[model samples]
Target: MKKLVVLLSLTVILSACSAQASTNKDSNKDDKEKVSQSSEKKQTSSDVYVPNPQLTDDRSLLEIGQAFKDDKGVSSLKAIKKVNETYRIGDVELIIHDVKVIEHTPSYSMIDYFHGFTHEETFDFVKANIEIKNTSDQPVYFSPIAILESSTGEHRDWEADIYLEELNGELAANGSKKGNVGFILDHSDKEVEWVKIFTSDLLNEEQKVTNKAQEITIEF
Candidate 1:
């Protein structure tokens, strides 16, 4: 009877150890899966692009433009034209810095944003850097580029702009803003010799037109 009792005790001990080992293995597998899922989430989040990102330092419009190109992995960039012209309407001042023609191949992560513009993986576009300021003591509403027409007869309204820099809309008193505006070209090979910009009418706080809209042309 003593020998039988010892044998039973040993059987129970061995069974408990086996069960514990199995439980530990399952817990370790779950931990590994959780860690792998976390890694995948981090990688996916890093692939997303943020538009109109905040600048870390004071960078020129040209420098900002180059950074944008690099961020998007542009295959080719051609500065087909450069312009340094200023237009003033009523209490608002507008300046055009430069224009660039770029060829870009969108990554899989960027496909959704570029889908509306083109179906091709590789596409071309024209981008313009501009600045606007309100010199009055009161706020005013204005848009620097109401309508953009390329020399190849392709036209895009302000609503179609890809660069959502929030450069349009109400301008605070003595406030200034600068950014880029880009439009996809219908034909990548088409030559762009010039682009005509139509500015929106300057409106006061009462929504009354203080100044008529103007047309400005920039040649490459």
Candidate 2:
């Protein structure tokens, strides 16, 4: 009878030990899941892009230009990754997808045709495929007169734009637009190494024009 009682006690002890082991395994799994979820949240937060408030504040063209200079200017096309990266210039976010240099591009109008036929007034164009995004709370206007500042300090604006209807327009809060813009340059046999792209509110002449415009720069 005593042996039977001892046998029963051992069975009960084993059952209790088994239940505790199962509980520990389940608790360990829950801990691992919680840790994994926390890591994912951190990754998502790090991936989000936010513009610098100091750079995004309403500022003048010259002030924005100075800020650009201070930040060591913008990134060049070669430096940009294939993943659509947003760059903050003043209050504007700019992405230059591609830049193409076309030789002997025809001028914008019949006047160009008349001039070309009469005095050979043809020119070359540097076409750019760009995307601009406004991150500010207020609406911002973009100018088609994006200037190309050469390494030698020569600044030239677009002569003809056929990629988009109007280069100048208003972009609402959190708005984005993509289009092609072209710049006219003197026909040259030499290749351009790099040029900086500048968009300014100072280029606008309307009554609602604000001195709070910014000059955003992108290098290509």
Highest lDDT model number? 1
Taking all chains together, the TM-score of candidate 2 against the true structure is 0.44
As a whole number from 0 to 100, the lDDT of residue 190 in candidate 1 is 84
Stretches of candidate 2 off by over 4 Å are 1-85, 105-122, 151-154, 158-164, 201-220
On residues 13-116, what C-alpha lDDT tens digit does candidate 2 reach at each position? 33233334344443354344344444321221123233322111111112211322223122111111122344554455666555544433232333343352
Candidates' TM-scores? Answer: 0.68, 0.44
Q: Which stretches of candidate 1 lie over 4 Å from their true place?
A: 1-71
| lDDT scores of the candidates, listed in order | 0.62, 0.40
Candidate 1 TM-score, true structure as reference? 0.68
Residue 57 CA error for candidate 1 (Å)? 14
